[model samples]
Target: MAKKVVPEAERRRRRPTRTGTVLSEGIIVDTALRMLREHGSGGLTARRLGAALGADPSTLYRYFAGMDDLTRAIGDELMGRALAGWRPTGDWRTDLRSLGLAVHASYLAHPQAAVLTASRVTGRPREIAVDETILGILRGAGLSDPAAVHAYHAFIDQSLAFAALDAGSLALTDEARAVDEEMWQSTYALLPAETHPHIAATAHLLARRMPHSAYPAVLEMLLDHVATRIGGGGGGEETPHG
Candidate 1:
């Protein structure tokens, strides 16, 4: 199916606001992200968005079908950032690691927004391209069709799942987030040795490392599985150098 291009060009020609602010998809999305950051997801209403954009709520509908559509576009923008300047290195493991880190970083960069949209299937250009790229990399690595597809599924899903989990923690209110951090240090690290010997033994290490993201570790594990399945330490063959 042919995908509809976001009407960015058309949106650029949209009428100027009462405050003389030019309205475009970029401006709207930027404003929306800022609003999301400042006010949390619940505060990103169409009415509020319009006020921030210096236009009526209905005016936004001219560009976005509605809030859901606008949200997907915002999500796509994050995907676009992840893919930006990313070129496969033809070494599948290295490339996938780079790509996975890019994705993980992109979501962490916008924790609030990521919490809202990390699991979404936007069907936008960047999202579609990313899926194709991951699948292509798996196939290019010499996996059979089923193996490549299955690996692709595990890789993408795991990446997003970790992103969402990490982002959710980061998105919590400061007090709540601090509680989580405290729990790692004060609670987990203080478990009784006789009751939970393993956790007690690793308490100090867990307190220190638990605050960090596990996405990289998880990504490497997934890649290791893929490598084993493909009959190589990494991909069976290097991706063709461009």
Candidate 2:
């Protein structure tokens, strides 16, 4: 019998012992992530990534079906990074708040990547773990399964939406930022008092407020609404009655 021969592709697929030219799913994903961060999602083409990694594009196809697959892998990597070193505290509010803020901060750190991945639902291990952790918190807070699921959906959706919006805003050029500022100072500040008295009155406060202050406050308000609906009643402008 003649000896069977392994193809070059299959040979490369085998794990490298010395690690000079490694070609694995993890390596592809890690490289894609770096490329994404450096070039933004728009700039991460398979050809460019393959060139950067010193591998044939076909090798990437062996690991990922296409760019979409590679993007999902990158999303999983981002999720893993966000959840790394995060352990849940028993207090439901604290745990949920921490998780939400951690995710928000992580996305902010990679705004371009966040813009690409925040809206995506990967359903990968880290994403599942996040859902489980959130459901656990809601359940601990005495929410029914349906309510917990609903709240979790709202929580995740709101967080990602806010992250995407923030990332988009943050990506503005310096001139664009100045234009936004001028809009606030000129147009928004000069609203006609007759038609928009309330807005005019609060324009000063709105202008003076730190741009990032609203996100946490809005998140707290959303949580407060969920708390109220769950009969937890710590929300809104009222003190708890004995």
Candidate 3:
């Protein structure tokens, strides 16, 4: 007997699986993110995700090409969340700072998801919009092509790097995290002034500041560096490199 072939249009139409679970790309990605948060990075596997979604594992491929494709979707979801209510102000430094903070906050909110997706470039809609906004800000600042490209590169690289690092730290088990946090006081803070004068001198400040995320301060420093060169560039948007 020949297996009945379903029409493509019928398949693409809104439908549910045998388990009566309505699955869309958004729902899949959202569930994957929630699973990541609940179970940590290693917890989101095909079988487990299938069980969680109440659908067969193969049903996921109906929405995404494969796990890699789904991973990129997951990444894009984070970017979308970051940019959801965010609008870029005209001022470059102010806008960029807000963008940085928004991305970092989104990552912190979904640390396990961030750890898994932060280093993965989706090149999806949300990611492209981010690129457009950042480049727009730099070009709007009258930066030369080379300067704008450089700043854009630096901005994204630093953003992802810090997001990955901080999110990975947050993803650690509470006991592991406690040990890492305790090291500031137990190890570095206890260094003797005679042998480690610099560390010891700053130990007080380090104790006060080390537990917090440094991405905000780093963003300010990067903005300050760009400020020094923006006025020197003397080029409007679309200006060619010298």
| Ranked candidates, highest lDDT first | 1, 3, 2
Candidate 2 residue-wise lDDT at 150: 72
Candidate 1 lDDT, 95-182, residue by residue in tens = 9999988888888788889988888989889888888899889888888776787787788888888888998998888899888888
lDDT of 2 by residue, 66-148 (tens): 77766676666666776785777787777888888877777777777788888787877877877787888887887766667
lDDT tens digits, residues 1-242, model 3?
32342443543427676577677778788889899999986889878888888888877766666777788888888888888858867778889889888888887888888888888989899989888888888888988877788888888888888988999888888899989888989999999999999999999889878878899889989898789778677334432452
Q: Poorest 10 consecutive residues of model 2 by lDDT? A: 233-242
Q: After superposition, how far is residue 80 of candidate 3 from its true place, in Å?
A: 0.9
Q: Model 3 lDDT vs. the true structure? A: 0.81
> Which stretches of model 3 miss by more than 4 angstroms?
1-14, 234-242
Order of all candidates by TM-score, from best down to worst? 3, 1, 2
Each model's C-alpha lDDT? 0.83, 0.73, 0.81
Estimate the TM-score of every prediction: 0.88, 0.82, 0.89
By summed lDDT, which 10 consecutive residues of candidate 1 come out lowest?
233-242
Judge candidate 1 at residue 3 and give its lDDT: 34
List where candidate 1 sits over 4 angstroms from the true fold.
Answer: 1-14, 232-242
- Among the numbered candidates, top TM-score falls to 3
